[model samples]
Target: MEQIVGSGKFTYDVNENWAHVPPGIEMKPAAVAVDSRDRVFCFNRSNEHPVLIFDSNGDFLMSWGAGMFRYPHAIRFDAQDRVWLTDEHHQQFMQFTSDGKLLRTIGEKGHRSETGVPEDDFSSQAWRQVTHGGGPFNLPTDIVVVPNGDMYMTDGYGNARVHKFSADGRHQFSWGEPGTGPGQFNLPHGIWYDRRGRLLVADRENNRVQVFDLDGNLLTIWPTELIGPAFFYVDDEDTVYIPEHNAGMFSIVTLDGERLARWGAPIHKSIHGVWGDSRRNIYVVQPGEWGRVRRIVKYTRR
Candidate 1:
């Protein structure tokens, strides 16, 4: 019998071999995104062809982005179907055409902000030293572009802030600090500008989602009972999908943060990325930090 997951109207059967990886090719997917055509793009950490493209039905279409990234983190599409990618290790974010042509690159490569954290300090307690917010990024995790072409990024790992930018790549302003307060953040891992005109930030380490206005004003909070809410993918109907890392699970929530359904696997943990197609089929990917590494899963709607 095939493994089935999810609940309520969000259930699906796992398609383990959804992507036909060519011979001698591997997909160490860090995150996933879909274009207007619902073409699946798997932004991975591999050295060769880190950007893997696939058809809606799991056929391998093409690949690109050879030797262009280190520690690929998040991949998202904007209103124009352009690609936005974040790389925490490189301490930068980049923009690309859907075909993998580099348009612009942000952040000074190899430069980390002075967030009171040491080099190579991955300790849990290290974030406590972030006395205040910083500029553009210091190991930024995820990004989002609003309808008006404004951008927001969760500068999580090495900093505790959400940096906003203009459509032309100019720094606008930033918000957040290191603490457990309403507008504060522990690790602002993921950011998404929902259709409701609210910025949903996955404040991962704090175990909550912080909703804010476009101008960085705190609106509300959703203690959606998630662990390590790494990233988000909001569907057309304003339904929210998130991959919770520590819980090894993903959740389906309404626009108001009400849980519709949630599911996880015993063999999976640290699910960092999640997206879906028009067919309602779900796609998820994983990295090696928690348990499993280099895995991309597809769950077809039933």
Candidate 2:
């Protein structure tokens, strides 16, 4: 029997084998993005094939970035269809042409910021000691380029901060610290800009989504208890799709943060990333346990 997920107008049919991998080629997709041509790109952790490209019909197209990344954390396409990737393990972010040519790189490779205290310090540590608007990145998890060419990155893992930069790769300003306050973040995992140009951050560890203006002022925060949001995909109609790892489900919400729908495999807790293309087909990356099928599943609206 064909399994279906979601409800109402958001329901979809799951295609587990949407894209086939060659024999002996293991992949654990860390992030996913679609370009203007609807070409799907999967950023995987494997050094042998760090980036995998696929056509809209799920056919494998090409692979690149081998021996060029330590950890493929996130992928996003700019307005010009250029690709931007973040390597968390290497603590660097890079830009590439659509044809896989390196354009620019940011951050000092393999170096972590001297700031940020471990979990043991808890909330007692001074905010300045943990986050001082450091340079480059400590361990960036995700990035987004605004329409004006300004860039923002969630400096994750080693540093709890969000850095803003120019299109030409100059750091402009940064904000956030390690705490539970209004401007603080635990693990600001995923980020996206809405049509109104407001920034929405998936404050993963805090189990909430924080909204802020481009200038770093906290606007609002929506509590999403039990849903550890790992990533986001805001559709053309302003619908937000969040891959919640802790809840093992996708939480569908509106631009104003209203929960509209939720669905996923209740027995599985592997959904780590999500993206949707022009046709409204949703793609999710499930990095299943050790030997399981670490694959990207396509959900077509029924």
Candidate 3:
């Protein structure tokens, strides 16, 4: 045995630093996503090559988005395989061809809402400053597009709300406010559509993942088992891979909010992003202080 980690059938053989960029490239890995073709994309908060692509065998395919974003926050793919990206400092949602050609952009570049937090400040506790829910983004975090072409982005960090858009990228409506009550969020960091067509919002500061209908009705909440999730990636089987930002743990849970497998050390902080490939392998990325997560890890399926 190769020192398996995780639990139950979701165990894996850990392969740390599975990929590397050329000399002088910085990958403060912010978020990660896997395409249908088995290519893994690491979206980082780096000035150079913000997007790093790799094959399932851990081969460096290519790098893109050099100087394209101030701080690349999230990455997701549509059914057509187009890349959907979000920028924190820039405060915009971006669309691109799979090869990294820009197709469109949303939101005002460098314009943030009236959240108490300033555009330049990114302290972890800044959520306390979000007095009210604002517009499209203020350090926007993650984006998810459903089958009907409706999109949802977790406008967290500087603001506490989720913005929904139509297939054409028009703002349909927005929901949530700064609070601990149901339908309210403290820091709605990550987002995804569950297998049952319900909306799942990672209410990070409140230490729970709140599920809602598309109309913004609160359904249920998944309290952190002493973990604060930063992002959520749902696999084909409806298992959720959550990277706990506060406790530095990785949790594999089900649609019913049951933890299938959870693992990590206390020293690990900001396990910011997670993605599962078709081969049952899991990809994890961390965005902490520089010189951390020197190489992103791939948890090979056991």
Candidate 4:
């Protein structure tokens, strides 16, 4: 495993070597996304610059997207290399270019509604409530891009549902409800489409990951023995990494839901997100102290 720490303009790598850090940018980074060029993008709330770019070796590049985000919680890279971000407080999903150019924004701010009733039981209505006619979002936490360029967002917190959008930001379909049933979710915080294009939702408060098809069919569920399974990441090898916020650690499981390896220090009060790089280095994000003292720790196979 390797570790790196950054504060103000100073960054120290695993060997305690001084590394290049961006200037005039500081925030408790809650999420990170790496591009195909290996450039790192850090998303944090405090920095007026919501997105900070850095080279693989920690060289300071540039920063942008100021004044556009409200509690930017997670950042992800799409197949086309475009960047997608979730603003939980703003209740919206945003797309940006690699250079931080705002491409599109979906969802309305401060709009709230009750959806997924028997009348709107079809998956399509859930998508409309989030994308078309501008229905209110309770809190949108995470986003993922499908293999075909569509997008899937977890509408958690206030509302329990998942909304899908086409590549052009059109509402495609949506599913989920605020129950503990097979297709229900309690704080569906993080979502991702696996290699097979199957959707996996981290039913956070429920402590399980519910698998569903593109059409909202409940396929399977992976129950976690721990509480608060907040986020999930499926690797190219079909292994799943799940981070439990309550436990302050992450577990690696097979696609079939068998526990493999687990690692972390109990010192982490809350683990929020997880991501893996090309080299299979696992990165965990912990947002702490009102975003004042966040940390990203990298782990590797022992």
At residue 241, give the lDDT of candidate 1. Answer: 91
The true-versus-predicted C-alpha distance at residue 151 of model 4, in Å, is 1.9
> Model 4, stretches more than 4 Å misplaced?
1-24, 114-136, 223-226, 287-292, 300-302
User: Which RMSD does model 1 reach against the true structure?
Assistant: 2.2
Query: What is the TM-score of each predicted model, taking all chains together?
Result: 0.94, 0.91, 0.94, 0.81
Q: Which ten residues in a row have the lowest lDDT in candidate 1?
A: 286-295
Instruction: For candidate 3, give the lDDT.
Output: 0.83
Q: What digit string (tens of lDDT, one per residue) describes model 2 on residues 100-166?
A: 9999888888877656544333231233245544555666789988998888999756667888989
Lowest summed lDDT across 10 adjacent residues in model 4 is found at 10-19
Candidate 2 vs candidate 4: which has greater lDDT? 2
Per-residue error for 180 in candidate 3, Å, reads 1.4
- Among these predictions, the greatest lDDT belongs to 1
Candidate 4 local distance difference test against the native: 0.70
- Segments of candidate 3 deviating more than 4 angstroms: 223-226, 287-294
TM-score computed on alpha carbons, candidate 1: 0.94
* Model 4: pairs clashing at backbone N, Cα or C within 3 Å: 111-136, 112-136
Q: Which residue pairs overlap in candidate 1's backbone?
A: none
lDDT of 1: 0.84
Q: CA RMSD for every model?
A: 2.2, 3.7, 2.1, 7.3
